[model samples]
Target: MKLVVRVKLLPTPLQAAALEATLHACNGAATWAAQVAFERDARRPLGLRKHAYAEIRERWGLGAQAAQHAIKKACDAYTTLKANLRGGRYGRPGTKRHTRALSKPVVFRPEAAQPYDDRMLSWQHQTRTVSIWTTAGRLKGVVFTGQAEQLAVLAEYRQGESDLVRQGGEWFLIATCELPENTLNAHPVGFVGVDLGIVNIAVTSDGECHSGRRINRQRENDRALRSKLQKKGTKSAKRRAKKRASKEARRNKDINHKISKRIVAEAERTGRGIALEELTGIRERARLSKPQRTTLHSWPFAQLGSFIAYKAKKAGVPVVHVNPAYTSQECSQCHHTARSNRPSQARFACKVCGFVEHADHNSSHNISRRGWMAWVCGARSTAPALMLVA
Candidate 1:
C-alpha cells in the first residue's frame, strides 16, 4: 500500500524565496513545454522531453532532473487530453467545434508544483531536514516538522518521490511511503449493509446511523455567509468568504474520515464484508428541484464510500457494491417489493405483511441480503431475487 504523509517545512527567508523562485521557474517551463507540444501535436513523453529539455535547462536555470520533470508534466497534460478524446469525454483538439477550448496555454499558479525524484532530493533523518535541487541551486538544511508518528513513518518507509506544495502562506513537504499490504486469515462470515442518505450520512445494518444533521447545519451556515459576502461585492469580503468555504470543506472531510473509520472498524471487528449501493448517476435520476439539487450535490456520499472502501482494504475487510434498485421499498422481513412500502423519508411500512422499520435500516438489510446472494452465487445474474411466499 502507498501512503502520503505531509510535513510542515520551515525554510529560512532566503531559502523560502529561492524555493518560491524554483517553483515558478519549473511551472513556467512546464507551461511553455505544454504549449509547444499542443501546437506541434506531439504526445509522446520521450519526444516532448527531447524537444523541451535543453531549452528548459538553459532558460529556466533548472538542473537536469528538474528540466526532465517539467517535460514530463507537459506530456502528462497531453496524455490526459488524448484519453479524454478517446473516451468521448471531449472533442478532438484543434477542431472548430470542440467541446473544450484548447487555444489557451496551460498556466500554473505559484502553488502549482512538481515532484522531486531521489536524484534531485534527499532527506536527513537525524537532522530532520531535506535538501532539494532548485533553479537557484541546491538548498540544504530545510527543516521540516510533523507529528512523531508521521516522522517515524518517514524515517522507516519513505519512498523516492516527494512533492513541494505551497498553500495558505505555508510550505509543506508531502512524502510518499511504502507500507505492507494487510492480509486477513479469516474469510467474511457475513455482510454488513451501509445505506447512504442526506439526512443520515450512513446507516449500517447493525442499527448504527451516523447523523448528517451537524454537517447540514454547518453547510447551510457557510452557504448563507458566502451569499452575504457575494452580495457585498468587495475583494476582501470575497477572499474571506473563500477562506470560510475552505474551512467548511476541511471540517466536512474530517467528519467523513471519522465516520468511515468507525464503519470500517465495525466490519473488521465482526469479520464481515461491507455492502454498499451502486449509486452512479443517482443525482441525475432523482430530477430534484434547484435547492434540492444543490443539497444533493453537496452530499459527500462518494467521498464517504471511497474512504470506507480504502480503510476496509487496509484492514483486510472486503467491500461490495450492490444494485440499488428497489432496496428501499423491498421489505426486509417479507421480501415484498412495493413503492408504497416506504410511505415517508424516515418510515418504512410493508403493505402486505405489515412489517415496519426505519426506511434506511430496512434498505440496509435488503442491501446486505443482496450482497450475500452475490457473494454466494458468484454471479449477479444467477443471484436469487427476493419474493413473497404464500
Candidate 2:
C-alpha cells in the first residue's frame, strides 16, 4: 500500500527563499511547457518532454531532472483535460478548446522538489533532518517532523517521489512511502453495515451513529462569515476568509479521519467485513430542493467511504459496497419497499408489517444484509435482491 506522510519543514529564511525561488522557476517552466504543448498538439509525455526539455533547462536555469519533471507535469495536466473532455465533464464542445492556464506562482514537480536518488533528498535518522535539492543549491540538515507513527513508517518503508507544498505560510514535504500490505485474516464471520447520510455522517448496523451536526454547524458559521467578508469587498477580508476556509477544511478532514478510523476499528475488532451503500453518481441523480442540494453537496460521503475502505484494507478487514436502491425506504423486517415506509427523515415505520425503527438504522441493517448477500453470491447477484428489503 502507498501512503503519503506530510512532514513539516523547518527552514531558515535563506533556505525558505531559495526553496520558493526553485518552486517558482519550476512552475513557470511548467506553464510555458503546457502552452507550447497545447499549441503544437504534442500532448504525450515524451513528446512534451522533448519539446520543453532543452528550452526550459536553459531559460529557467533548472537541472535536467527538474526540467523533465516540469514537462511531465504539463503533460499530466493536458491528459487530465483530455480525460475530462472524453468523459463529457468539460460541458463544452471542441477537443482543441482553449485550456485553462496555471495561475499558481510557485509549484514544484516531484523531481524539482527532490532528485532521482536519495543523494539530493534523503532523511538523516541521526539528526532527524532531510536534505533537499533546490535551484540555488542543495539545502542539507533541514529539520522535518511528522507524527510519531508517520515518522516510524518513514524509517521502515521505502520512500518514493514527493512534492514540496506551501500552504498557509507553512512549507510541508509530502512524501509517498510504500508499505507492505497486511496479510488478510480469516474470512469475516459477518458484515457490519455502514449507512452514510447528510444528517448523520454514518450509522452502523450495530446502532452506532457518527453525527454530522457539529460539522454542519461549523460550515454554517463559516458560510455566514464568508458572506460578510465578501460584502466588505476588501483585499484583507478576502485573504482572511480564504485562510478561515482552509482551516475549516482541515478541521473537517481531521474529524473524518477520526470517524473513519473508529469505524474500521469496530469491524476489525468484531471480525466482520464492512458493508456500505454504492453511492456513485448520487449527486447527479438525486432530485433535491435548494437547501437539500446544498446540504447533500457539502456532505463528504465519498471521502468518508474512501477513508473507511483504505483503513479496512490496512486492518485486513474487507469492505463491500451494495446496491443503494431502497435501503432507506424498504422495511428491514417486512420486506416492504415503498416511500410510505419512510414517512420522515428520522422515522421508518412499515405500513405493511407495522415495523418501526430509526430510518438510518433500518437502512444500515438492510445494507448489512445486502453486503452479506454480496459476500456470499458476489456483487453481480446482489442487485436482484436489493428490492427484497429483509
Candidate 3:
C-alpha cells in the first residue's frame, strides 16, 4: 500500500548545478562498479573464480563495500533470470541476458537519499528552509522554496500522503500511508469493463468513454514545434525548446492523472470491481499509421494501470486485468469470434449471434466477463471476493 507523488523542484541556479553534480557522481560510481564485475565474470565464472570480488575491488579502485554490493547485485540478477528461463511458461527461453548501465537507477525505500534525520522535518512553507554542507560548497541561504503555490506541492508529501524521489531531471513520489481501506457507501456489487484503444483513450462497459483527442493534439503540436526549432537552431530557439519540453512532460502527466481518477471514480460509484485488458503483445501488434506511432508510444498505458490498481486497493474494491487475446473480436453476449463481428472500427455486429454494440463497449463487456469467469473459477491468487462497498 505504498503511494508516491512528484512535484517540480525549484532551486536557485547554483543549487541546481550542485544537484546535477551530485547526480553525475552517483552515476559515475555505479558505472565503475558495474565494469569491475563485468571484467571479473568474463575472466572466469563464479564457480571457478574464488577471488572474483577481491579482483574487482582491486582492479576498479572501488571501496570494499561498493565492490561487494555491485557483485552481489549482478549475481542475484543473473540467478533470478536463469531460474525464470529453466521454468519456461510457453517453452521459450526467459533468460534476460542484456546488462543495464552502471547507473541503471537508484531507489530510496524508507529514506531515498543519505543523511536521514532521526526526526522527520515538519512542513512549513513560509518559514521552513533548506541548507547544504559548507565544506561541500561555500554557499548559504540558497532559495530551495519558490512561491507558496510551488511549495504547496510538498504538502501531500509532508502530510504523509506519498513518498518522493528525484532522478534524471525529474521527481517521482508516492503516498502509501493514508490509503482508505474501503469506500463509505452502499451500492449493489457489479463489475466495470475497460477497453483500451489508440484513438479514444479508454471506453468503459458502463456507457462512458474518455477521449484522448486533447493528448493527441498536444503531441502533434510538439512534433511541429520540434521541426521548427530544429530549423531555427539559435539561442532563443534553444530556450523555447526547453520550455516546450517541460510543458509537454507536465501536460502528459496531468492527462494521465485525470484519466485515472475518472476511471477510479466511475468504479467506486458503481460499487464494482474493475476489469482491464492485460495487454501482453500490445507493442508488436499495434496497427497504427506511421504518423500516429509517436503519439501512441507516449500514451502511458502502464501508468494508467498502476493508478487504477492503487486507487482500487485504497477504496477496498478489486481491480482485475484479464488476458486481452480476443476481447476485441469476441462478442460479449454470445461469445462469437470473427472479423465480421466488427464491420468497422466503431461498430460491433456479431455474425453467429445477431448482437449489435459499440466496438469499444463490446470489448469492455468481454473484459468484464472474463474477469467474472476468473473470479468464479478462483483463477486469481491475490484477488478475493470484494466485500460490500459500504
In model 3, state the lDDT of residue 361.
90
Which candidate would rank higher by lDDT, 1 or 3?
1
Query: Alpha-carbon error at 79 in model 1, in Å?
Result: 0.8
Off by over 4 Å in 3: 7-188, 224-246, 287-295, 379-390
What's the TM-score of every candidate structure? 0.90, 0.87, 0.63
* CA error at residue 350 for candidate 2, angstroms: 2.1
Candidate 2, residues 363-382, lDDT tens digits: the string is: 99999999988888764211
Encode model 1's per-residue lDDT on 220-268: one tens digit a residue.
7878888899999899998998898778777777888888889889988
Q: Which residue runs does candidate 2 get wrong by more than 4 Å?
A: 45-51, 95-119, 380-390
Measured by lDDT, the strongest candidate is: 1
- Name the 10 consecutive residues with the lowest summed lDDT in model 3: 381-390
lDDT of each: 0.80, 0.77, 0.58
Better of 1 and 2 by lDDT: 1
Q: Of models 2 and 3, which has the larger lDDT?
A: 2
- The candidate that wins on TM-score is 1
Model 3 scores what on Cα lDDT?
Answer: 0.58
